[model samples]
Target: MKKLHLACLFLGTLILAAACKRDTDFNYYYYEPADFALLSQYLNLPDRPENYQSTLPKHLQSLGLAARPVDYDKATLGRVLFYDKNLSKDGTISCASCHKQELAFSDDKKVSAGVFGLTGDRNSIALGSVLSFSAYYGTDLFGPSGVPFFWDNRANTAAEQNLASMTNPNEMGMSHTDIVNAVQTQPYYEPLFRMAFGSNQVTQARVSEAIAEFVNGIGSYKSKFDSEAEKTLGYNTYSNLERNNFSGFSAAENRGKLIYLDNCASCHSPLQGRPEKMKANNGLDAATVDAGVGGVTNQANDMAQFKVPTLRNIELTGPYMHDGRFATLEEVVEHYSTGIQNHPNLSPELKYGYQPKKLNFSAQDKSDLVAFLKTLTDQELRTDKRYANPFK
Candidate 1:
């Protein structure tokens, strides 16, 4: 009886030890309550400054362009919405799926995959420096300076753009009603919605607005180029020599800057006063299938026109162009140097009389051009925790 009692005690001790080990393993795999509390702070944000301007360097601001004020709560709400896969029909995709923060908020894929493994038609355009969109495109500020959104410029505002993506069958595949229901069902969204709109009610318009505020808050100006540009006189006052010999740039990069100014600046000027007409047919083909802006306007003259994206983070946001045809900067340089075709509505900037003019850049010039483009990369924007995924 004593031996039997001792045996029972030993078995009980082993069982208790095993239970404790299992509990420890479970705890190790899951996030702690403290970790969740810290993450929740991102979702339930504090009030933002009413007149919050972007963190972009002062020297980079265009003369007449004013920074739009940001509401912190709204933008924080946007950040959550941007990353939430629950917004999709199957809970498989989010805005971050295409516009990844690591790639300057652009996709590495030539075309991004949407919900259910469907691929988008065009390469995703990078969302870096989107804060400048309203200032550059708003009709009240810069008359006819920019179009709505997308490669074709179909949507009028960032909110409209977000809605288009969310509803598109190939993208998020959720309707207005469905989006409201989906968001409402998620427990985490109630707090976010309340913070953003002062109520926990989820509406389609409010969703888009929150997402747009978040997108519009993203800015990139801490690049090597901005650093160098700031050290010189203001963008408007810089002399040709000062502009070319920007501080910290190597001789090759400086030479390439001159080449860019001479050849590429009319359409893609680094300084302010962007072209009034934002879209251009960059002589991609003599005849093309994609009607671009013409598809929206149904104007024959607008055929083949596409929106001109800012060159702020061009180095990381490639393969270049609307269709993502050119995989490398060298390929892009080659296209401009020799591959320009004669399209009837080609921009005057790319034309010498009736023929599409070739840049005829030498091999060395092409290499230097690629080197200079790399200087535009903003390292801080790539790793900034504020824009990072808040969800564990």
Candidate 2:
């Protein structure tokens, strides 16, 4: 009996030591108890702003689009995956490596450096800079039309985009099988996968879906522009933009708004109105060096055309344009003001009689335009703990 009791005690000690080892292995990062709770607060939010429906123009009211919902548990898991550099082949890059939170989830580099020090061809597009991802890509913001991901509009869904980035040689540089192995090898992910999918089994599909859910949960609606827009109910039509002066804005900001409404809003869209055009050749280059959408579709009409991303948080997200060519907002405005090159596929809005149309913006016009653009900056999104890095 004495020998049996000693044997049992020895086995218990081994088990305890093994449990401690497992805990220490996963302790490289710490996730709080509160962080583990789904809360169901940040994710699963409405696609549009509260007053969005009430302020829609009569013509736009009949779209009959429903908001897409996000899963909180999945998003929580995604937050971990986004920051985990182990997802990369060399264990040096993650989704957050390219898309940083401080710069509105955009990289400040002209072209982001990926795993193995390879440089990407284009700028890192900002995520969650404008409306919620659901509204921006879902039925409402684009007016019942699905918005494709990436500058070239190659991927139709967020999952596809995430997978593409993971597999891209210049990005994560991980195969689907490699990605699965990486996640499975991590000691911390067992509980995360169980919490997210009710199973500890990790898969590429689940990883992409969870990351998309987390991304879709991110939003930037608490800006000065949103505040003023709410107070004024809404600015539904392009015609009324100049007529209404936001009570909260300074004269310079209001002046800039007029300039933006007249020149920029046709594509960017103020408030929540549908942009007149989604993709356009903004005359970045005279000749097709990159070919942009044309490269993806092999269609001549799509040449030099790129996704016209929303200008929200334009202050933080720079250098501007798909190639990150322009270093400052003034440079961007100057492009439209005097530097629009006559690309063959130039959008009609930028062309007058086929020659590059110059706005001839005065110094005051340029300054005010920058001022109005700054109003779109949302401090909440930049500092929100919910969307912050879960690993400490």
In lDDT terms, which candidate is top?
Answer: 2
lDDT of 2 at 261: 83
Q: Cα lDDT of model 2 overall?
A: 0.77
> Where does candidate 2 have its weakest 10-residue lDDT segment?
45-54
Candidate 1 per-residue lDDT, tens place, 1-392, comes to 99999999999999998778553334431223553454455443323322224754555563455556767767777888899898998899999999888788998888888988898888898887343544554444344555468888887778889999999988899999989998888766776666668888889999999888877777777788777876774645445543558768998899888787788777876553234357899988899668999999999989999987667777788877888888888898898999999988999988999999899999989988888878878887788676777676
Error of 1 at 25 (Å): 36
In model 2, which residue pairs have backbone atoms overlapping below 3 Å? none
User: How well does each candidate superpose onto the true structure, as a TM-score?
Assistant: 0.84, 0.82
Instruction: Encode model 2's per-residue lDDT on 171-217: one tens digit a residue.
Output: 99999999999989876677667767989898999999888777877
- Candidate 2 local Cα displacement, residue 327, angstroms: 0.7
- Model 2, position 185, has a per-residue lDDT of 87
> lDDT for each of the candidates?
0.76, 0.77
